[model samples]
Target: MKRWSRAAVVAVSAVAATALVLTGCSGSNKGAGGGSSSPANGDAASTVKQAADVMAKVTGMHVSLTVQGSVPNLAVTKLDGDVSNTPQTVATGTATLVVGKNPVDSKFVFVDGHLYSDVADPGKYADYGNGASIYDVSTLLDPNRGLAKLLSNLQNPKVVGSEQINGIPTTKISGTSSADDITTLAGARLSPKDAQNTPTTVWIASDGSYHLVKIEISPVQNGTVTMTMSDWGKQVTATKPA
Candidate 1:
């Protein structure tokens, strides 16, 4: 398999970082979800706010992502994993990466605030220290600072109507925002020029919990990145590496 560029690796590393950050100590709080097809009063902004509040209480979840044309030199076709936020955040999962024309298998684990990577070709494990970590997890799940802020700052959010995802009823919303806003939410800083415009769509569960079910980001240069989140309230735990 071909080697992945450092930048590419860091890009995907965001997955693990966010998985741990967003779930950290959130504590299991049951959501006030209803099976309604639309949000209260069918208001998009209110719906987003309500959903944000619901997701902020999630203790653990499962994430599946497909990143196509998002990063250069690395082709991350699919990634899936589980994460827990209560007490401590922990994660483990596999990713399918295509470097050049060859596909490589990569495994990742996050526990005790440390990140570990294993590549099938090398068949060895390397630890990326928490201090040197490239991705910032706290910025994603922080109710006041990260994704909540981004959603609150959404420009002209519009209701795209209701849809069903994975058999779950959801309210879809579409909007546009500066990439800088997202970078901040993800704990990344980009040069002004590099902060291209981004179009986003999000699906919030209508079951009353208003938890986020899916999100999509389309960058002018990188194509589209999609993430689907589910299994809310599931228990997840990670042990320190031996």
Candidate 2:
């Protein structure tokens, strides 16, 4: 597998960092919400808000992401990792990138406010200044700017139905959000055309906790980005490379 350049990796990190922003919506919606375990009396907007609130307080979670199609500058096709937000935000994960039609894997760790990756120097970590600027996974837990905000800002939200995700019951909600809002949260630059209304879907745990389980976003006409989160509050440790 061919390793990508620093610039390319930076682009990949930006998108990978935004993987956790799956918790929120950005505008108002009108729809009847009724599900087996719907929150806020089966109101779609209310249910989404509750889930966003719950996600805001999460300290740690396991996240997985998959991207289909293209986004400017973003090269990562898949990422799986554990992220911690309390005390100090940190994350460690495996990232896969498609280079020249071939997939390459890399190991990454964020600790002490910097991103370290083996892509630049095979078998050794290379320092990438300012993890937050490069790939701030902590943003996923931000109440004001991350998932919470996204959920509250969702447009035309409606409770479509219910489904089981990873064996956990979840209520499904669908809506649209502006591309600009998503770009801000993800910290990735998107094409002007993508600034139009983007379709979004969220699945919140129906088990009363209202934790966010999955989110899907269509940023372009034929491209989709999906994120799944689990193991909320899990203990995660990221150590500086030796």
Go through the candidates in order and give each one's C-alpha lDDT.
Answer: 0.67, 0.77
TM-score of each: 0.71, 0.78
lDDT of 2 by residue, 1-242 (tens): 99899999999998876764532221111223332334434789888888878887888899998888875555667789998877887889987766667777878888887878776556798886654333456667777777777887889888888899999988899998877657755555678778678888999998889999998888777778788999999867879997
Candidate 1: segments with Cα more than 4 A from true spot? 1-41, 72-77, 98-102, 120-123, 131-140, 144-146, 184-196
RMSD, one per candidate, in order:
24.2, 23.7
After best superposition, candidate 1 residue 237: deviation in angstroms? 0.9
lDDT per residue (tens digit) for residues 1-242 in model 1: 99999999998999889887767534322232344333434888888887777767777788877766644322456667777756776777777766567777787677777766564345565776641232333344556655556676666778878889999988889987686676654333445664665687889888777888988766546656677888988877766545
lDDT: worst 10-residue window of model 2: 23-32
Candidate 1 matches the true fold with a TM-score of 0.71
